[model samples]
Target: MMWKTVLITIFAAGVLADDFSQITAVVTSQCTKNNAEDKVPEVEAALRTFGNCLKGLVDLNVLKTEIEEAKPNGALDEVFKKYCDKSAQLKGCISSVLQGVRPCVGNEYANHINDAQNSTNQLIDFVCYKDGDRIALFIAEGGPECFQQKTENLKTCFLNLKQSFPTVESANNLSLVEKCAKVDEMTSCIVKSLEECSTPTPANMAESLIKFMRKDSPCHTALPVSIV
Candidate 1:
């Protein structure tokens, strides 16, 4: 959730180009494929309502300005502290919108929407309330630079890592051991990249990630030690 927020903040701050249009295209493709053509308009309207609700929650112009001004250091934490204070209200708004739209969307679409909402809630709770201190420390210790400069590298590494595993319809199909191994592989890839990029403090970055995986992730049951 913090990562999504960070990417949005960076884009708002003019650090990245408009790749969101491409993302929108992909989402549109999926929507058309998954939902009945007749229900597409209803789905679009539901998404619009959700967007409008978000607009009412926070001033995008103000948020963009703040992010732009905050810049290279502490921006992520500062933005989170300032804006994520309203995370509870945001979550409530999300739930309310989804409830209104669930009846109109297909079951498959509804399930995906609910899953997205749950993931958002989890990330919000993790970064804004549960592990704020750890997140702040991670950001302070070269997390931003590593993310900013090595985003494509990290993305490529993750994609390649995923390729190593057998393709499955759902992650639930993977056993706990298999999931833990994937998590370990992904962490190792990230840690390796941070070190390769000469991030200001790769160890701290790795430690934070290790702690997160061990304490918060599905792999928690299996991951008891630092992967780095």
Candidate 2:
């Protein structure tokens, strides 16, 4: 009788261990990255914390027992069936982790990078106010030669402003801008992906973020400045 109870306890613990292994595997695969260059410190920290929590849930001793109890009669599957809610728990935990981490993520790119901030602001005003069109029209009334010069000046201004930052702060500020831009792009991609995943388990969410980031796409393309 005692032996029977011991065996049952081991098997039940093994089943739970299996579930934890599955959940942690998914979390680790999704959170781990190769290139640090494209990572934001806050996002990376969140990923690390989330991964560690998932890994901590795994029980190695029970996992070993599960390996020993492998039978051809599908006992493991039967045990797994008892924990129908495990998947749901994983999904809920993932949502909770993301919610906790979301507050840490911010538009550091636009906030910290003076050059990017100025460029973005200028672009917004130019597009919204049609400043370029008015300048082009004003210069065109003078002569074709004057209009051409105006167009050149507009292009130069756009390029110069996009590249400009305080000389004292350029080196450090540029690095921060690059990191923040990648983080912004990654956060945007992850948000879009989470919307698509009706049930975002740790694995599913991680997979989505990893898939998008692996593409290594550019953050933004330069807009053409038309003086004509």
Q: Which has the greatest TM-score?
A: 1
RMSD score of candidate 2 (Å)? 24.5
In the range 49-86, model 1's lDDT, one tens digit per residue, is 55666777677788667655665655656675766777
- lDDT (Cα, tens digit) per residue for candidate 2, span 1-228: 112222222322333342455433433332343222233344444445545554554445764465347334435443333332243443443444444333222333213233322333433333223323322232223323332434544454334433443343563555544644534444444344333433334223334433333233233332111111
State, as a TM-score between 0 and 1, how close model 1 is to the true structure. Answer: 0.62
Q: Give the whole-model CA lDDT for all candidates, comma-separated.
A: 0.58, 0.37
Cα deviation in Å at residue 219, candidate 1?
A: 2.7
TM-score of each: 0.62, 0.24
Candidate 2 backbone collisions, by pair: none
Instruction: Give the Å error, residue 124, model 1.
Output: 1.6
Model 2 Cα shift for residue 180 (angstroms): 24
